[model samples]
Target: MSALLLDTAPLRSSPEYRRLWIGLTLAGVGSQLGVTAVALQVYELTRSSFAVGLVGLVSFVPLVVLGLYGGALVDAHDRRRVIVLSSAALLVASVLIAGQAWLDVGSVVLLLGLVALQSAAFAVNSPARTAIIPMLVPVEQLPAANALGTLSMNLGVTVGPLVGGLLVGTVGFGPAYTIDVVTLLVALVTVLSLPPLPPLGGARKAGLASVLEGLRLLRGWRNVRMTFLLDICAMVLSQPRALFPAVGAVLIGGGATTAGVLASSVAVGSVLASLVSGPLGRVHRHGVAIAVSVAAWGAAIVAFGLVLLLASPSAAHTGSVTSTAVPWASWHLWAACTALAAAGAADAVSSVFRQTVLQSAAPDWARGRLQGVFIVVVAGGPRLGDLVAGADADALGEALAAVVGGVACVLAVVVLMAWQRGFLRYDARDPVP
Candidate 1:
């Protein structure tokens, strides 16, 4: 049982890692709070869902534009310094958000601008922070460390929005933003305590040349590249989040509340998987683990689509009060949630190993750059998935769209494995990236 639970070896062995983990977990919660508050505020001001969506647009643009440059900056400067500076920028952005809210400035434009600034700071801060993890923990402990990280993120996603909604409903947006500011202070203090972490070997000046240099290295690092490709396939081809609203309304016999529940189900599975990830450390063939986990994710998604298909015949009756009022007891709803939870669990496992491979196998000098590209793929892939899922649903019903997407994801993995047969043999004991 002990071996089956979360491995605390990384936390117990490294005081720095322990502190950093705590701080990051707290900050992640606060970040989510701010995000929720901003979106809600935008909706309140403009009363348009599109305006709320524009927040994501503004945030994503900065993240994609600055993600690589931030990685280059991480390689060029002291990682600790880079983190501190970016964190400070985040603090300033949060303050501006809070200030505007408190001052009763109801400008959607200002709010969107502040969100962009926050996203830009996060783009830089994330890579530096992730790159610093390898320096704090031993190679063997990378999986556990990353599992803990994933757990933290899922927890934040689970808890933060609920708290933010409550605060926004009761106190107002200002208090939620204030809470975020306080959390950022805690994160900054923890980061400040870390020792200097300059680039390994030598530093390259941060510029386009340095960014190109990092991309050039991917040509030789087949295993590390494969990690990103597999993740992209899983997220882009199999993600079904965009279908949640329609699923709840038509097939599931519920409204917005059901959609929220469906969304939370994924995070619940991620958290549960992370809690029982102790056994993951015993596995050394990271490449095989990732492949199997992604395949499992696709399979689970297929199962979810099947459940939706089974429920489709009842769409006409779903609008009746009996179905919406008591949707929890509906077998179809439970089955769909179960399938999504399973998919989330598989995704969490895949993320742990994929992150481990990238952190442990990549050279320290290029770790930041790789991590930067990682942020891009992780952020961009889901958006693409949402687009594809939406379009497919429009063309061939939601259930069939999900089915096609999951099948494509599985086939993509098989093709990748066939093309890069060496990736399957990649061993954690002898990382070849």
Candidate 2:
């Protein structure tokens, strides 16, 4: 096997990481189902794109606010216990949703509220989980550990939405929610099997102080700060999944099926890339690797938007960019799918390096807290991207918004590469502490 694949082996070899990976993947599947059901139910009831956005928005504050404190808590407390509590909360929330569904008393308001609760539970659980990885595997294997996490996320992201949409459409929301409950229960067993994680030695108490400490540490490192900023920019600007339903209906004309297909495409790319990512094990210049991958993502997205403009039929909706020459199959949907997939593949590469950088750089005591913040940023990014894409799609157009976002992603990465000399110049072999 290539070194990249072998590097990840250390992570795969760890029994505890393996168990957590499986559990989290299953839980993620359930969560996505609940999300799809809520969005479907909200749109069906209120018949408003705004309501769908609201479902995402409602989950935001809980995820952000709790994310920081929760990470700090992860640093100060037992990680295994935190995972248990988070899982338990998610389980209860899933049960509540299932009960309401079974009783046929579904309320959009109630569903949104429950989603917020589940997100908050996840807020606590996510950081502890991220923090625990270093403990489970040796230091050099951190990149592989991160790759494993990304792989699971890609699988869950792609499969979960499709399954969630299918289950809701076929058997009603009850079955959709119940599946999550069952999966979550199965995940709980994984958590139960984990050994206790004592707090890292010399970790500070959890509070605003800890939050500030995390912020300070993250900012002190020029690369980390820029990385976090770049993530925010790319996510808040160019994410296209939020606009998928509208695009499927108005642009591609396939409804939920198309949306599912489109949604899964990005994950498809990521999974495929990661599967062959054994090459990643050989690279040492992780910073340059991250910067270049992000730039590639920008180019891919821009190309996707170009697909829309180049197709004649899409040109009609997008105001005659292609002029009735190109075939229908060569239109907006195909382009979007292609670009999103490319972006996903590139992101997986960047993620492996970024995770490695942080794992190696972070102080032992503060690792959990910092990781918690990272998880929060990572999780909440898509929602922000959704809102941004949705708003822009209303004012400008979906095609235009995607194009702009892609350009922005490219520009941002280029700027970061130029500015963060230390990050770009840092040697992986010798390391920089």
Candidate 3:
């Protein structure tokens, strides 16, 4: 039973890690609340889903542009100081968001600008925080530590939007944003307590040269590079999120509510997987584990697509009726959710190993920059997946699109494994990056 449960060894072994984990979890929830509030406010102000989507665009741009720079900054300075400044920037952004809402400024541009600032801060803050984990915990415990991190993130994803919606709908955006401000402050205080983490050898100047130096490490490090490639395969080729709205309305008959349920199912699976990830820390063939997990994700997605096909004969056609209430008794809905949950679990497992490999294998000086790139791949891959999934659904029907994507993802993994045979033999005990 202990082997099957989540390993709390990392938390028990390191007080600093425990405090940092708690702070990150709270701040993650708060960040989600702010995201939900901002999206809702945009919709209320403009009544346009497209306008709401612009929020993602603004956020993504800064994250991509600054993510590497942030990592460079981490490598160049005391990581603790970098985190403190960036977290302060996040708090200031949250305060402005709340102020604007309270003042009834009602400007879409202003709201977007604030979101960009928050995203830029996050771009810097995340890499520094992630890079510090190795410094705080034992090498053998990296997987467990990463699993805990993933658990917290998924928890925020699972809980934040629901609470944010309630707060915004019942009260107003101000209260939601205000709560975020409080959470950010907590995060800031926790970071302040962390000891100075100066660069080990000597700090490189944080500039384009430093950033490019970090990027160059990827060229020589095949194992670390494979981690990014596998993740991209899983997220880009097999991700089925964009198809949720159509799947709920037409094949599943649940409408927007159904879409919400389907979307949340993934996070639920992630949380459950994290809870039972104790055995993952003992595994040594991390590369093989990553491949198998990604393959499982593809298989689960394929199962989800088949369930959709089985549920409705007219699934390929457009203009179907959408329902308000979920058909709780329907086997198709249950099956589809189960498949999505499985995919989520596989994804969570893959993520633990991937992060462990990156953190364990990369040199400390380059960890921050690599983590920045990791953040970019993590954030950007899903958006690209949305575009790919949407295009495929439009041309080939959602069910077939999903089927094609799953197949593609599995095939891509196979090809990658064949090309980099060494990746399959990568042992965690002797990390090679």
Candidate 4:
């Protein structure tokens, strides 16, 4: 039982890591609150789902550009300083968002711009923070550390939406944004406490040449390259996350309440998976584990699609598309939520392995660059997936689109596995990055 539990060695081994984890967990929850509030606020501003989708479109470019450049910057300077400055940028972005809400600003364009700024800050912040983890913990404990990281992230994801919904419904968007600002301060203090983390020798000046060098390193690192490739496959193929709003209203017969539940259900599963991920730390074949977990994710998504398909067409197509609530009381709603939960759990498992593989395999000097690419794949793949899933959903019904996407996801894994024989046989005992 002890071995089957999450390893706490990283926290026990470093007080700085412990503080960083706690601070990040709280800050993450706060950030989620703002994200949910913004989505709701945007919908209120313009009753068009297309307008809401534009929010994602607005942020994607900055995130990709900054994510790559940020990785180079992380390697070129003190990671702690980079993180501190990025956190401050995020704080500023949050304050602007709150100010707009408090002022009752009526422009959706301004809101989109703020979100893009926030996303750019996040693009810089994530790689530096993730790269810092390897420096804090030993190689053998990378899996556990990664699991703990995922746990905090999912906790925030699960609670943030619920809290955001309540705050927006009761107090309004201003208070929700205010809460994020307060939480950001807490995270900022914790990051300030972290000791200076200068990069090892070979860090070049932060510029185009540096960014290209990182890309060059990424291209040659087989295992690191495989991790990014496989991750993109999982995210691009089966990520119908953008459709949750529609699923709740039409396919599931509930309104916004159902959509909220469906969205959070995935996080709930992720939290649960992390809690019991003790045995995962003992596993040796991380690559295989990632592949299997993603495959399971696809299978679970397929089940969710079936649930939507089996529902009556009347219920599947009726209801106001806006994220306003109708109570969710149907058993079918529960089934759909359950499937989403399963998919979320599988995704969490895959994420832990993928992160562990990258952190453990990459050299210290190159870790930041690889982690940057990892962040890009993590942030960008889903946006690309939204384009894929959204187009499919529009062409075919959402249910059939999901079915096809899930099947494509599984097939994608199989094809990648065949092409990369090295990844299929990768052993945690003898890692080869």
What would the TM-scores of all predictions be?
A: 0.84, 0.90, 0.85, 0.93
Off by over 4 Å in 1: 33-58, 94-114, 161-182, 243-257, 309-327, 390-401
lDDT scores of the candidates, listed in order: 0.81, 0.74, 0.82, 0.80
Per-residue alpha-carbon lDDT of model 4 for 1-433, expressed as tens digits? 7776777888899888898898889888998777667766765665444454566667777888999999989999999999999999999999999999999987898998999999999999989999999788777778888999999998887888767766765677789899999999899999999999999675568888878888888667787788888778778777766566566556665444455567678889999999899999778888889889888888888988888888654544445434444445667778888998998899899899889888877888877877788888987787666656766777787788778888888998899888888887888888788
**lDDT tens string, model 2, 345-407?**
988887787777777877778877777777777778767676777677676666777788889
Report the candidate with higher TM-score, 1 versus 4: 4
Pairs in clash, predicted candidate 1: none
What TM-score does candidate 2 get on C-alpha atoms? 0.90
Worst 10 residues of 4 by lDDT: 315-324
Kindly provide the TM-score of model 4 when superposed on the true structure, using C-alpha atoms.
Answer: 0.93
All candidates: CA RMSD (Å): 4.2, 4.5, 4.0, 2.3
What would the per-residue lDDT of candidate 1 be over residues 155-175, giving only the tens digit for each residue?
775566556655665677789
Off by over 4 Å in 3: 34-57, 95-114, 165-179, 242-260, 308-333, 390-401
lDDT of 1 at 81: 97
Model 1, residue 180: distance off in Å is: 4.1
Question: What is the TM-score ranking, best to worst?
Answer: 4, 2, 3, 1
Query: Which is superior by lDDT, 1 or 2?
Result: 1
Candidate 3: tens digits of C-alpha lDDT, residues 1-433: 9889998888999988998998899898888667656766775675444454466667777888899899999888998899889999999989999999999999999998998888888899899899999989988788889999999887775666556655664677788889989988988898788888887787989999988988889999999999999999988787786676566556776544455466667778999999999888888999999999999999899998898878773443232212355577889888888998899899899999999999989988788899999987786566457667766777787788889899899999999999999999999888889
